[model samples]
Target: MRAVLNKIRPKEKEEVASDLKDVFDNFSEDDTINKAKEKLEKFIAKWSDKYLKLSNCFNEVIVEYYFTYIKFSCNIRRMIYTTNSIENLNKKIRKATKNKQSFEKSSRLLDFLFVIIKDFELANTDEISSTCFLFLGGLRHNYRHGPLQEQQS
Candidate 1:
């Protein structure tokens, strides 16, 4: 989405992002996996010509292994598809580590970093019970398929 948005004029980017958000917002309203898949396909088709990056990204999000490999739970969380958690983790670790002048040893640095990670984990505890995939709200676990692996380019 960011890739496609970067192509737009700066003046129209915010409005376009908001429009895209509306389309994504509909996912939570869908009551079943098929309905959510339908919405995703519709969204891909609607933006395929205009935003190839978004089309590919959404396609990647829906796959046989993705549904099969992840042990999803009812405790769904919003914006799970975004890289916010991973990025936030990086930022928090950097900020926490930067406070120290230097580590006496690598083990000490590792221990400090571990504490930072644990603190972040405790803060975002939703990740422990949240669905591994987006649009998984109220979705059934009937999509089990093949083993998990990296998506081929």
Candidate 2:
């Protein structure tokens, strides 16, 4: 997929110009450009009322139409928005479980998180604190000793 996109992208500008030239040349009836412009204007005017009516009709029925057809539409944004939050949460949980595969019980997981919250509370005690210290402390808490260290100590 990526290779195909890159392959086509190299020729995009030339391809677009070629398509535009074809479209422009297709409407020409005479050697004069003004005749082409005149024909384009007449053609646009002939369809303008139908276009306007369709636009208004869609606006009036949008809610009903959307409910009827939105499920069939493949909207990336809607799919991402609905799934990303839960996906991110699952990713965090997966990382947590990967780091500590020995957590055989839910209570142990809760206990580990409780210790982390407590450690952060303790680390935030002093008024003169550095962000680096907090970040390092949190990293160590999550990845290094964890609650097991405190239990052993």
Candidate 3:
């Protein structure tokens, strides 16, 4: 695994470093700028090597072993490194579920979450598709299209 990671390490470092540089260059300097630059440089230095390893592992296991072997490629995102979007979504869901102390079952919780997600998705489907793949995963899993699964009297 390490050998595999080492192979693609340089490309990954370059990509991450370039991306960090772009983001860092956007901010203007005060004390915050220096702090952000320092943090970002350190992060790029540390994770760039590891990110390739992680990606390679995923490629090897999920893509090669599972997807290729099975001949089915899923649309799952490789990295979910960013979290602010989900924190905000959870805040919204928490507000909605504040009144309910206990969910009767996991499915009930899922149903509630689905409603919240579907309503949000109706407004900004594109942004939701791009930024929040996991949210899309949950939505896809929970979605019931066509006629209702259960017949109504």
Candidate 4:
């Protein structure tokens, strides 16, 4: 996928990426799979002729299972849908392992990776803890006891 994306000129790449984002954003807004499908069809109709390969790739590979994320809670949906953290982790792992030629055993490689990941977790613990506290506080005060809910009631 990255290779295919890289093949596009920079300006066209941005446009294509934005168009793809719109498709996912539409799916995210839908409350039901039927609505999502409808939105997806409309998106496909708009883009399919212009970007046949991308439309075909999504229809063939993604349309089958992407809607399942809608069933999860907002936090879970965010975690599942966004790849930034996972991609960052992958980049770190690649950098850490790039110098090494080989490991005697897969277990040894995993052990090394575990230590690296543990160190990273420790390094970020403070930031993560503060974010968690802020997230919980927001949930309590904003959603549970905010003015919007009062007005709705």
Candidate 5:
């Protein structure tokens, strides 16, 4: 979508971009699939007059899959809608493999990817570790105190 947006003439880019952003802002506020579709339809009607190509692109391509997000929670919807996390991971993978022309086998490529993913996981383990400790402590406290209260009663 950003690629398509970039194709707009420089003179019209800012206005069109701002309009599109406003449409997305409205769409994101919708808690239901039906409301989201309504918002999109309204945006298409409003913007089509000014940016026919951009509006048509959304109507023809993007709206087709818009309902798929309805089953997901808002947090997941936000994550899926944004490209930052996946883009960052892709950037890291591209940088790591940029110098290599080709892998000897598919397994070799998979091995490299596995190592990269494992390294990222290990780098992020501190937060996970602390959460795990807090969870385990709560469980231990409950187990120790729960039986004692039951026996006294």
Candidate 6:
């Protein structure tokens, strides 16, 4: 939304921002999945006649990804779409591997990555929930260390 607002002229930015808030009033984060699409459709229709581009963009990109968080339980909604931490971890992996050039074999790469990523995981485990730690696919936690809850099969 900040990106959208940045495109507006400063003189009218606030007014346009308020108008865009109507999009949220129509279908905010707290909405349930069943009603989300309907409200989104209504918001699109409300603007389609007046602002074709805005509505089209909203429908095509924004509304299309709208169900992303609504599909998850609200407890984990904030964690669903974020990539900053993942990107940071990726940066670390890249930095660690950059000087190595190449691994001798596939297993060598896996072993090297396991150590680096495991270090990153341990570094992050305390900063975030163990449940969200599940984000690190296949980086399983030992039960003795305390899982927020048991992993489901």
lDDT of 1 at 85: 79
Per lDDT, the best of the predicted structures is 6
lDDT of 3 by residue, 79-114 (tens): 122345567667877899999898766656766777
Candidate 3 lands at a TM-score of 0.37
Q: For candidate 6, what is the lDDT?
A: 0.61
Once model 3 is optimally superposed onto the true structure by TM-score, how far is the C-alpha of residue 133 displaced, in angstroms?
A: 6.8
lDDT of each: 0.54, 0.40, 0.48, 0.57, 0.56, 0.61
Worst 10 residues of 4 by lDDT: 141-150
Model 4 C-alpha lDDT per residue in residues 38-131, reported as the tens digit of each score: 7677766765675666555556356757767777654456555666655665677789999999987664665566555545546666322222
Deviating ranges (above 4 Å) for candidate 2: 1-81, 112-153
Model 3 steric clash total: 0
Worst 10 residues of 2 by lDDT: 72-81
Q: Sort the predicted structures by lDDT, highest score first.
A: 6, 4, 5, 1, 3, 2
Q: Is candidate 3 or candidate 6 better by lDDT?
A: 6
Among all windows of ten consecutive residues in candidate 5, which has the lowest summed lDDT?
127-136
TM-score of 1: 0.45
Error of 2 at 36 (Å): 43
**Which candidate has the top score in TM-score?**
6
Estimate candidate 4's alpha-carbon lDDT, on a 0 to 1 scale: 0.57
Off by over 4 Å in 6: 11-30, 34-52, 60-62, 126-153
List pairs with backbone clashes in candidate 2. Answer: none
Model 1 stretches astray by more than 4 angstroms? 7-16, 26-33, 44-71, 98-110, 121-153
Model 2 accuracy (lDDT, Cα): 0.40
